[model samples]
Target: MSDAEAARALAEGHLVILPTETVYGLAADAGNAVAVAAIFEAKGRPRFNPLIAHVADAVQAEAIAVFDARARALAEAFWPGPLTIVAPVRDRDRVCDLARAGLDSVAVRVPGHARARAVIAAFGGPVVAPSANRSGRPSPTTFADAVEETGAFAAAALDGGDCAVGVESTVVSVLDGRVSLLRPGSVTREEIEAVVGPLDRDGEGHRSPGRMALHYAPDAPVRIDVVEPRPDEILLGFGPGVGALRWSLSPSGDLREAAANLFRRLREADREQPAGIAVSPIPAQGLGEAINDRLRRAAGFVG
Candidate 1:
């Protein structure tokens, strides 16, 4: 579908599947309570988990949320990228309480996908979007999977090819004069710290999204840090020397490449109906942190 069509669907309180750098999102007009509620009902997502309100630029973002100096600096450095900032709500009417999960704060971001920005720009307001998949399922990173996952619920679906990042945006909260890392993604903690000092790893009471303990799961069971896969399992390998059953994320051990392929590979492996999905060990640095974070959640190892 065209951007104009998607925007029209959103304006009429309908759901639209949109692609972003991170993953395909099921989008709705943030200001419309009925539209935002459709997202939760379609995804079967928990009402307590807030949705990220996407805008065309930082100017639109600031209009919805109160951006502090830290928030502004981070926005200046990472707007139009995969970074979400959770801040106190400046315009509750623009981003309704339902979209914010009834919290006083709202999670907002400027997506780096041209088509997504075009749709939001055409809509002329904040769009509350979450990964286009059923709750607890792996997020769709391709147009085909997005349509297969939740197309029935969307009024229109925009095909923007495959997502580049294949992960959700890195979410951080700039509240109470402190920066807290709510969720990791393609953006690393080291990079964020460089921009705004250290980050509070323990974000206790923050209303950030994507914090479910058993998220990004697939139908098949997942086993992380596996050296050898069981006979009936599919091995998702990393780096070189991954003999037999070689579904290598990156043969050269490149974290960025691995991050881009994470969700797509998980979906592919799940389609095989294997006994379990085995993943090789990935380093806990850079984009690997986000990759491993998703892997751990898929394996139901995260608490």
Candidate 2:
């Protein structure tokens, strides 16, 4: 769909499925309570889990959210990329309470995708767009998958091709002069720490999204850190030495590539109707941390 059409649909208080660098999102005007409500109802998402508002740039993001020094530094470094900053709301009345889950903070980001920026710029306001899928389902990395999940409910679907990151944005909360990592995503913890010294690593008292266990799952069960695949299981391999009839996340052992392919690979494995999916071990460093975070959630890990 065109940007004008998508913006128009959003202005009218309707859901719009649009692409981002990370994943396709179910978008609506963040200031419109009814529009935000449509997003929750369409995705079957629980009201407690808040949504991330996508803005055109850092200036626009600061208008709704109160960004401290750390928040400003992070936004200056990672705006227009796969990084979300949950900060205290500057004006509660400007942002619909539903979008913030009735909290004083709002999860906001400036997406890196050109199409996403175009739509936001055209729409001329903040738009809250969570991953465009039913709650707990694997996030849609492609337009076709988005159509299957939200096509019926969304007023328009803006196809901007496959998502490059193929995962959610790294979520960090900057509240009370502290930076805490909430959910890992395409951006690494190391990258964030480089900009803002050490991270608090605590998510308590924050309403950041993607904190739930059993999220990003498919129809079949998933087993992670598997070195050997059982006969009945579908093998999702990484690096090398993978046998035939397996989907390799990154044969070159590149964590960035592996992170980009993680969700799509899992979705492909689930499509095979396997008894379970056996995922090869992915080292926990850099982007691998985000990859493992998604894997653990897909495997139904809690805590």
Candidate 3:
């Protein structure tokens, strides 16, 4: 569908599937309590887990969430990209309490996808969009996977091709004059620290999305940092040494390329109905941190 159609659906308090740089999102009007509730119902998402309110720009983001100096600097450096800032809610009416999960703070971001921005601009309001998949499932990074996952619940679906950043946005909390890394994504901790100095490793009291111990998982079991795959297992290789049947995230060990292909490969491996999925070791640096985060969650090894 077109952006105008998607915006119209959102304005009428209906769910819409929108494509973003990170992944396809199931979007709904944030201010509409009933509409926001539908998202939880459709995705089987827990109400306590808050949704991320996607805006067109930093100006719109500031109107909904209180942006401190750190938040502003991060926004100036990373707006229109895969970075979400959780801050105190400035406009409660614009983002309903349900969307914020009854918290006083809201997680908001300006998506880098132009079509997504266009839809938000046409809708003329903030929209709560979470990964377009069932709760705890791997987020859909392609239009086909998104439609298959939750298209029945949406009033319209906009296809913006494949997502560039396969993982979700890097989420950070800029509360109490301190910046804490809530969730890592394509934007690394190093990048955020460069703009806002050191980040507190502890993210207590900062409710961010996608924090479940077991999330972004596939049907088959996942084993991370595996050097070899079992006979019945499907191996997702990283750099080199990939066998004929194995899938390589990046033959050259490019973290960015691996991030872009992470979910898609997981989905493919799951389709094979393997006994388990074995993943090659990925370095814990830059985009690899985010990739490893998702992998750990997929393997149900995260705390």
Candidate 4:
């Protein structure tokens, strides 16, 4: 659909799947309660977790959030890119409580894709979007993935191509002037600290949409064979056990390359459904954290 066509549909309060620097997001008019509800319904998402509203820039984000100097500073440094900042509600009474799950805060970001920015400019209001997939499923990097999973929703989607980041944004919550790392993504904690100073990790307050104990899981049963998984199990290389198990991330233990290849590996492994999958623990560093993060979530890693 044309940008105008998409905007019109969104104007009438409909859901849309749009690409961002991080992942493809199913978007809806954040200002319209009806439109936003459709996103949760379409994805079978619960109302307890709030949605991240996407805007073009500070001007738009300010309309929806009460940004402090820290929030604004971080936005100037990392926004129009892949950083999601949590802050106190802007015009508290004005923002729909449904979007925040009745929390006193909201997660907002300015997407870095040209097409997404254009859509925000065209749609002319904040668009609340979450990973465009059914609840508990792997997030979609391609529009076809979203279309295939969400099935048929009346809203429009911008096929702006694959998300380069291949994951979600780093989420920082600024509460009481203290920064907390709610979730980690492409932007590392070190990078965020460089911008916002040392982070004070507040415990995840509640069941945020993306903060599931078990998230980003494929529709297949998964088992991480850290040691020798099981005899009948589909084996992957750890140090020296590389057999034909349909797929393996890398018997090589290079986390940077591993991070880049994660989703692709998971999708390939999912295709086989060969008993269960095995994983080698790469040293936790740079991209390793992210790689482990996805795996932990996929493996339902708690604490």
Candidate 5:
């Protein structure tokens, strides 16, 4: 279906597979109860796990939540980008609570993709979206992945090509004047620290969506390969190997590129339905941490 039509469907409480700078999101009108519920149903996602609300601008974001001066500053610095900041839902709780699973806090961001902005502007409300796929599967970077999960619910999917950034947004929650890294994503801890200063570093054990030790996982068992590909395993972040399927993170070793391609590659391997998948080891630091986080999740760690 057309993007405008998809936007219309979403505004009318239907699901649409929409593009984001990071990945395709299973999007719904965040202001519509039935629409938001459909997103949960589409992914078989637990109610307690919240979705990130997307907007076109700061004004739109502020209308849905209470964003103090700090938030405003960050919005000015990062909006039209891949950065999700947790804020009080306030008036938007009426519509967003269903997306947030009754949490007082709402995850919100203004994606950098032009298509995403276009869709949000067309709908004229918060669009609470999560990665478009079954809850435990690797998030989709293309329309093909969305169709695999729910073709009926995704009446329309905007073809914005593949997502530019394959990883999720960096999520930070400012608490008692301290910034906490709720999720390590496209934006790194170092980058965030540069902007927000030394973080409180919640360091896991936090009740947050992406924080679950196990998240962004596929149903197939995952094993990380530090040396070479194993015969029976589908190798990810490498190239095709004789006995094993090869997938490489980034031949150039670009963390951001690897992050962008991470899920797409994992999902490709999953389509093969190998008994298990083995990931090649990425650097333990930098975006490698972000990449490893997703691998660990696929290996069965909860956020």
Candidate 6:
């Protein structure tokens, strides 16, 4: 669909599947409670897990969220990129209570995708968008995946091509003069600490999306750090020396490439209908940290 058409759909309180730097999102008007409720119903998402409000830029983000020094610093450094900041709501009335899940704080971000920014700018307001797939499914990185997995529920789908970052944005909660890492993504804790100086690294008491233990999972069971695949399992290989494999996240052990291919590879692996998926080990550094986070969640790790 065209950008104008997507904006019109969002203005009319309809959901649109749009691409972000991280993943395709199921977006709706953040101020419209009815539209936000439709997002929950369409995704089968639990209300307690709040949605992130995406905007065109830091100015639009600050309009809804009360950003303090640290939040502002991070936003200045990472706006138009993969970083989500959780802060107190500046105007509770402006952001529908349903979007924040009745919490005083809201998770907000300025996506780096040009098409997403254009859609938000054209729509003329903040949009409450979560990953454009059913609850607990792997986030869609390609337009075709978004259509195959989530297009049924959206009013329109905007094809912005494959996501660059692949993983979701790094989510940090800056409340009460304290900064805490809620969910690890493309932005690493080390990167955030460099700008904000020492982070709390806490993940509790916040309603940030993608924090659910079993999220981003595929239909088949997943096995992580596996050296050899079971007879009935399909292996998702990372580096060489892994015999036959259903798919390879990266052939040269490049984490950035691996991160980009993670979900799409899992989706392809699951399509084989294997009893389980054995995944080669990924280093927990750089984008690999984010990739492993999703893999661990996909493997059903709680907490």
Best model per lDDT? 3
In model 1, the runs with Cα more than 4 Å from the true position are 243-246
**Candidate 4 lDDT score relative to the true structure:** 0.74
* Whole-model lDDT per candidate: 0.90, 0.88, 0.92, 0.74, 0.76, 0.89
lDDT of 5 by residue, 135-224 (tens): 877888877777777656777877788888888887877545656777777777787777767878653223246655567887678887
What TM-score does structure 3 among the candidates reach? Answer: 0.98
Supply the TM-score for candidate 2. 0.97
Q: How many clashes show up per model?
A: 0, 0, 0, 2, 15, 0
1-303: candidate 4 lDDT, tens digit per residue:
887787787788877778787778888888677777888898888788888878888898888788888888889898788788888877653346788888878788899898888888898878787988888787877777777777487467779887777777778887787887777777788888888798886645462447777877875655663755666555444333465433555556655445545665666666677566666665566655666777777878762
Ranked by lDDT from best down, the candidates are 3, 1, 6, 2, 5, 4
Q: How do all models score by TM-score?
A: 0.97, 0.97, 0.98, 0.89, 0.91, 0.97
In candidate 1, which residue pairs clash? none
Task: Give Cα distance to truth, residue 168, candidate 1, Å.
Answer: 0.4
Q: Model 3: per-residue lDDT, tens digit, 115-185?
A: 99999999998999999999999999999999999999999999999999899999999988789999999
Q: Which lDDT tens digits does candidate 6 get at residues 156-262?
A: 99999999988888889999888998888888889999999998855554568887889899999999999878999888888876645448888878888888888
Global fold similarity of model 1 (TM-score): 0.97
Whichever of 5 and 6 has more lDDT, that candidate is: 6
Give the winner by TM-score: 1 or 5: 1
Clashes of 1: 0
| Model 6, TM vs. native | 0.97
Off by over 4 Å in 5: 203-207, 237-246
Higher lDDT: candidate 2 or 6?
A: 6
Please give the range of 10 consecutive residues that has the lowest summed lDDT in model 4. 237-246
